[model samples]
Target chain A: MSTSEGGDSPGEAGGGPDGTGDSGGLRTTLTRTRAATALTLRRRDSLSVVTGVTVIYLLGYLWAVGDLAPGFGGYGLVLAADPLGGLLRTTSGPLSFAPVALVRAGPLAYEASLNTLVGLGLALLVGLNLGLTYLTRKQPAACGLRSSTGVLAGVPALLSGTACCGPVVLVALGLQASGVILTAFQVLLPAAVLVLVGSLVAVGRQVRPEAMAAASGSGARGSDNRE
Target chain B: MPRLTRRRTLASLASLGAAALAGCTTDANTGGGGGTVPAADDRLPLPIEPPALRDAAVSGGPGKDGIPSIDEPSFVAPAEVDFLADGDPVFGVARDGVTKAYPQSILAQHEIVNDELAGDPVSVTYCPLTGTVLGFDRGATSFGVSGRLVNDNLIMYDRATETWWPQILATAVPGPWNAEPETRSLREFRLVWTTWERWRGQHPETRVLSRDTGSPRNYARDPYGDYNPREGYYAGGAPLFPPLREDDRYGPKRVVMGARAPEGAVAFLKDGLREAGLLSGQLGDVPVLAVHDPRYDTGYVYRNPDELAYESVDEGVEGPAGITYAPDRLPLDRIHTFDAMWFAWAGFYPETDVYE
Candidate 1:
C-alpha cells in the first residue's frame, strides 16, 4: 500500500479489492484526504451559500435604501441634473427591467429605485458571507474574506451613498458581511453550532474507510457528491 | 430521540416571544402640556391723572349755544402746563362753528387732546402714544400733511389747573355711510376717561397731578397748514385785513386728536359708545381712508387714533389693496376722508364750505 503525494495514484493502504491501484490512493489517502476533501467541499458550499445569501441581503439592502431615499434629497430632478445622470442613463438599458426610468421620473420613484438596488446589493453581500460560513466551519477564515470583500464593496457603496440610498444599502451589506464573517464563531453562536454540526456529519461520512471504498466502487457516488 | 426537557423547550419559547415583543415596541411619545395663560397689560408712565368733568360749581354765563363758557381758556400756560406733574384732562366738545372752544383748564391739565372735527379725511389719531409730540411734516410730499396728528389717538388737555386729562380714542364716531345712520350725528365724543376709581382697578399708584409737565413745541410743526392758504385766514381765501404771518399762532393750527390714553382706553371707548347708543349693528362697508405718507411710508396705512380699523399699503405703483379713493377720478358725491388730516366736503361747494 504505497502512497503517492497528491493522493491521485492507486494501490495505497487499504486500497480497493481490485489488487491493482486502479482505485488510486483513495483508501490510504482517506485520513489526509478527509480533511482536504471536506475543506474543498466546504469551500464550494461556501461559494454557493455566499452567492445565494448575498443576493438576498442585497435585495433587503436595496429596499432599505429606497425606503430612505426621499430623506436624502435624491429626487429624480436632482439626479437627472447631477453628474451621475449620464452614467445612470448609460446603465439604464441593462437595468431596464428595474424601475430606473421611473426613479428618474420623480423623487419618490428615484428613492424607490435606489432602495431596491441597494437592498439587492446588500442581500447579495450578506447572503454570500452567511453562505460561506454555512459551507465552511472556519468562521475566522470567512471573516478575513469578508473584510477584503467589504473594501471592494465599499467603493460602490461610497459612490452610491449620495445616490438615493443605493450606496447605503451596498455599504450596509458589506458591513453585515464583514460582521458575520470576521466575528468569532461564538459571536454567531447559533449559526456557528449549526455549521460545525453539519460539517462534522459530512466529514465523518467521508472519512469512513468503508464509505470511501463504497464511494469509489462506482464513481457514481463521487460524481453525485461533486454535483 | 429521547424525551425533550420541559425547561429547555419553555426557555426557547420565552426567548422567541421576547424577540417578537421587542420588534413590536418602537414608537415613543413627544410634545408639551396644555393650559390657559392670560396676556399682560402694560401701562405707559405719565404724570397726569385721567380726564374727568369737575364736580365743582359751573361758573360764567353760557355761550351763544347755551353751553357753560370759560373765558380766555388758557391751553398750556407756564404755571398750569407741566408735562411731568399734571394728570391730563380728556373732555368732549361739539363743533358749532369755526371756533373750537376747548376748556383750556381741561386742556391745560391734560396737555394732549383727542377730538373729531369736520375736516377732509376725517381722522382718528393719537398725539403722544410715545410721550412726545414730535410734529410730522407732510407738505410737498405725497400725503398732504395738515390737520391734527396725534400719537395713539389719545388726547390730554389741561384747562385751569395744571392737571391734564388723558382722553382715550376708544370708539370711532360712525361716519355718515355707516349702517347706523341715526347715530351718525351723535355729538357725544366716544372716548375713554381714566378716572381715579377706574385707575385703581389695575394700578396701585396715587392719582395726583405732578407740577413738572412740559411740551415738545420745538419739534417740527405739522406743515400741512403751510401749503394751504386758507387755513389761518378769513373765509374763501380772502386774506384778512392783516396779512397773517406763518408764525401768527392766533388762527387754527393743525390740531392733533387721539394721542395716548390709559391702558384699555380703546376697550372703554367701545363700551361707552355702546352705552351711549352710538354704535348699532356692525360697522358698515365704510371706505377705509388710506393715507400714504412717503416720509414714514412703511407701505401701510398709519392707523388713525380715531380709525376703527387699519392696514398698511405697499409703496410702489401697485398702490394698496382696498383703496377706493383715486385722486385723478375724484368722486364728488362720495363723502370720503383724505389720508391727510384735512376733511373733504365731498358734495359741498369748495368756495362756500369753510374748513380749518
Candidate 2:
C-alpha cells in the first residue's frame, strides 16, 4: 500500500523483515499517516454517528431550553409529539410562556452547557476509533477487529448521559448512580484515544517497506540494520 | 422522622436556591434547605402571633430571581440609569453617608438584592404581588427566598437559619428555630418608595442599582403591571391570594405607609400623607409620626422621640396636628417604614390598626 520513495530509490531507506518485498521505512510511515488521515475523514458510518449525536442533542437541548434565553427561544426540529417533553419537564422553567417562562425555569443553562459538551466529546471519541484501521493497514484484519471492538465498548459511554456533570450526580445518587456508566466515562474515553494513537505507532514500527535493507546499515560490522 | 445528622442535614439543604427562600413559610409553605441555610427544626421561636400568617393560594412565582439572588449586586453612577422615568418608583436608602436607589422597575424582576450597604450587610427586597419595598440589615447572614409565600407576601429565609421571614411580618415563622425563646427579626431600613428622578435629583451623587443582574429579566417591564399609570395589578385593591383576615376598611391593595415596632403595627393612609407631609398619631399609647418625603416620594413613620408631641401636636383633629414640615426635616429618631399593598399588610398584621 506504500507509495513511499523506497519504491523508487530502494537502497537509501531502511528495509523490512520481509526482505526485498518490504515497502521502504519512512515512505511506509508517510503512507500510513496519509491513509489514516484520509480514512478518518471518509468514514461515512463514523461521521453519521458523530453527526447523529450532535443533531439529537441540539434538538433535545433546544426543546428543553425553549424560549428561555433571548436567542434560544422557540421549537427546534419540530417533533410533533415533542419527544423531549420528558426532558423539558425535568427542567425547572415555566412551560406556558416562552422567554419569561424560560427565565423562570431553573437549570436550563446548566443542562445545555453539559449536554453540548457531552455531544462534542462523543464526536471526537468516535472519530478517533474510525481513523485507526486505515492507519494500521499492515495487519488489516487485526487492526479492524480492534477498532470495531473499541468503538462498541465506547458506544455505551456516549449513551450513558453522564457526559456532563453526570459523575457528580452519580456520586450524589450514591448507590443508584450506575457503576457501569461511571466506569465507562472514567476509563473508556482515555483508553479509546490511547488505542487510536497506538495504532499509528504500530504502523510506523511494523509496516517497513523494501529496498533499504542492503544499504545504510547503521553500518559498522552490523549483521542486520534493525534489531 | 429519621434522625438527621449534621451531614444529612447539610445535605438536605442543597435543594433550596437563594430565590427559593423568598416563598417559604406562609399563610406558610415548605422545602429543601441546601448547605448555606440550615433545615427548619423545632428549635426556632414561634415569633409570629396567629393571624399574622395566611396561605396565599397562588404560590409565589419566581419574580425574576428564579435564577437566584444577586449575592453580589452591581451598581453604577446615578447618571448611568438614564432610562428611568421620573415617576418610576424606587426604594432609596441612605446609611452612613451611602445613598443608594433600588428602582422598582429593576427590582420588580430581581425581587431581592443580597448586598452590603455601608459596612452592614443588607438585602433590599420587593414583592410586586404585595407591593412592598423594604430593606434588611442581615447582620452576617444573607437572605434567600425559600420560594414560599404566606398571605401573598414573599417569605425570605436566612442563609444561617432556614427560619422563614414572611415579607410583611419580618418575623421568623417556622423551621428548626421557630420555637426558640426569642424572636429574631433584623432591623429593616425605611426604603423611600419614590421616583428615580426624584431620588437622584435630591441625592445628586447617589448610586443607582444597575439592571445588569446576572439573572435574566425584562427590567423595563413590570410583570404585575405598570406603576406609572397606576393600572393593571394596582388598578383595584385585589389580593392575589386570599388573606388570613379580610379587612375592607379600605381597598385590598391600597397604598399605605406601614410600620412595625416592639409595641405594635399601624398603617397610615397615603392620601393623608400626600396632603400633609407630617401626620402624628398614637397606637397603643405610643405616639408616632408618618412623614412623606416628596423628594423620594416615600412616606416615613417615626417614633416621636419628642415625648411632648402627643400633647403639643393636635391629637384628634385630622389636619390640625399635621405640622407643616419638609420630609427631609424629620426628627432624628426615625422608625422603619415600608410602603406596602394594604392586602398584604392586612393579611400579615390582621390585628393591625387602620390610621386613615
Candidate 3:
C-alpha cells in the first residue's frame, strides 16, 4: 500500500507556490499523511496491524487507567444510578470521565466510561502510526521512517493513563507531587495525541510513490494517495 | 434529622451561643485539666470559619460519587475471608453487642461503606491521604466521598441534603451543591484503627466486610499504597496535596490519638500514649485522659474534668478510687476519638493542645 519515493519532500526542502516555507511544507506533509494513513487502512495486512495494535493498546490503556481490572470470579453487570448522566461527568482529571457501567466476566472486570472512547481514539492513532511504520519497514532501504517513532509516541499515552488518578503513580514510586507535575499530568493525554499525529506526518511524508512502486514492480500510486 | 432550614439555623445560633459561653469558661481555666467543654452534641469546633473551609475544599482527583460508596455493604465471618493479612489494618467498631471490621485494603478502594450496625445506619469512612478512619451515624441517608479534600481530609456529603461534611471535622460546611447548610455536625462514633489480627483475635465472631462490593475494583491493589507494611503514600512525609496548615512538631505521617469537642481539640502522640500507657492533657481548658489498650495497641480519650490521676496497671487502667477499669471502660465521660495522621490532626485543629 506504500507509495513510491518522490524527490519532492514536503517540510524538509520545499516552498509554497506563493513562497511560504515551513507552514506550507507542514500543510503538504499533513495532506500526504492523510492519504498515506487512508491507504494503510485499506490494505489487509496493514489493517490487521492497525486492528491488533488498537485492541492491545486499548486494553493496556484501560488497565493502566484502572477502568479495566482483575475481578473476583463472577459474571455480572452493574450500572450506575444515572448512567446516562454519568457519561459526560469528569472524574479524576480533566480528561478522565466517570464510569457509567461495570461489566464483570470470569477473571476480568471493565468499567465503561467516556474514557473508553478517548482511549479508542488514542489507540487508533497509535495503531495507524505503527501500521505506517510497518509499511515503511517492508521497504527498508527505500524509506527513511524510523521503526521507533510509533513506539516512542505510544509511551506518553500509557503514562497519561496514570494521569487519571492524580499523583497515584507518583505515590507508588515514592515521588512527591508538585504543582508543576500535576499540571503536566493534565496535559499528558493531549500532548500524546499531538505527538502521535505529528509522528504520522513525519513518517508519511518520507514515502516516495515512484520509488515504492518501482521496488514492488507496481504502478506509481502517489497521485492516488490524495484524499 | 432536621433539614438546613431557618429553624435549624436558629437552633444552631442557640447552640453557638452556648458554645461561646463555654468558650468563655474555657478561657478562664487555661492550665491543667480545668475547664469544661459543652456537652457532646454533633457539633465539634471548627479550626476556621465555615466559609473559609468551603473555599479551601479542593478536588481530590475524582468528582462527587466518583469513588463509589458501598451502599449495600455485605459482610462475612472471619473464616470466609482470605484477602487480609494478619498485620493489615482494619477499622473495628463495636456497638450494642454488634462488632464489625472494615479492612483498610477494601476501604482504600471505597472510602465510605454505608451499612447498618446494631439496627442503626452508619457510614464507615477511611481517608488514605489523612490516614483517618471514622464512623458516622448516617440516619436515613448515606454518606459518600465528595471526591473533595480540605486540609487533606475527606469531605463527605450526605446524599439526602448534599451537605459537605469533612470526615475529620464531622461538621457541615457550605458547598456548591448545597450552599447554605445549617452548619450542623454529624453524629460520630469511634473506630479503632488496629491490625486485622488484633481485631479478629479480640472479636473472633466479628463480621468482616466482604470484597463483593458491587463495584468492579481490584481490592488487592490500593491506588495510593499499602498499609500492612506501611509504604508509599501511607508512609510518605509529604501529603498528596498541601495541607490547610503545616506543623513541624511531628512527622506528617506520625499517628496521633486526637479528639475534639465544642470547646476545642487535643492530640496525644500515639507513641507517647503507648509508652506511658496513660497521658493527660487539656482540651480547651477541660482536662482529658488518654488510655492505651495493649490488646489493640489503640488509645481512647476521656474528658477528665475531675482531674483523675489514672495509672496503667497490668489488669487495666486504675482510677482515682483505685478500682481497675478497662481502657475503654473508664468511669469518666468518654470523648469519641480516633487515630489520625499528625499532619491531618494539626491541619484541621491547629490550636489543638498536644501531649507529647
List the DockQ of the predictions in order. 0.00, 0.01, 0.39
Per-residue lDDT tens digits of candidate 3, residues B29-147?
Answer: 11122321111244567777789889888777677887888999889999998778899999999899999999998998789999999998788999998989998777667778898
Instruction: Specify the highest-TM-score model's number.
Output: 3
Give the Å error, residue A88, model 3. Answer: 6.1
- Candidate 3, after superposition: displacement of residue B336 in Å? 1.2
Quickly count the clashes in candidate 2. Answer: 49
For residues B159-211, could you state the per-residue lDDT of candidate 1 as single tens digits? 21112122221111222112121100101122222222232232332222221
Indicate the residue-level lDDT of B40 in model 3: 27
lDDT of each: 0.24, 0.51, 0.76
lDDT of 2: 0.51
Candidate 1, superposed: residue stretches over 4 Å from native: A1-48, A67-99, A103-122, A138-227, B1-356
Model 2 lDDT, residue B287, Cα: 70
The TM-score of the first chain in every model comes to 0.28, 0.36, 0.82
* DockQ of predicted model 1: 0.00
Give the TM-score ranking, best first: 3, 2, 1
lDDT of 3 by residue, A1-227 (tens): 33333434334423423226777766766656666787677656677898999999899888887788776556778777678866887767778887778787778878899889999998898899888787777764555455667667777766766766666666666666666887888888888889888888777766543344345332225444323
TM-score of chain A of 1: 0.28
Per-model clash counts, in order, read 111, 49, 12
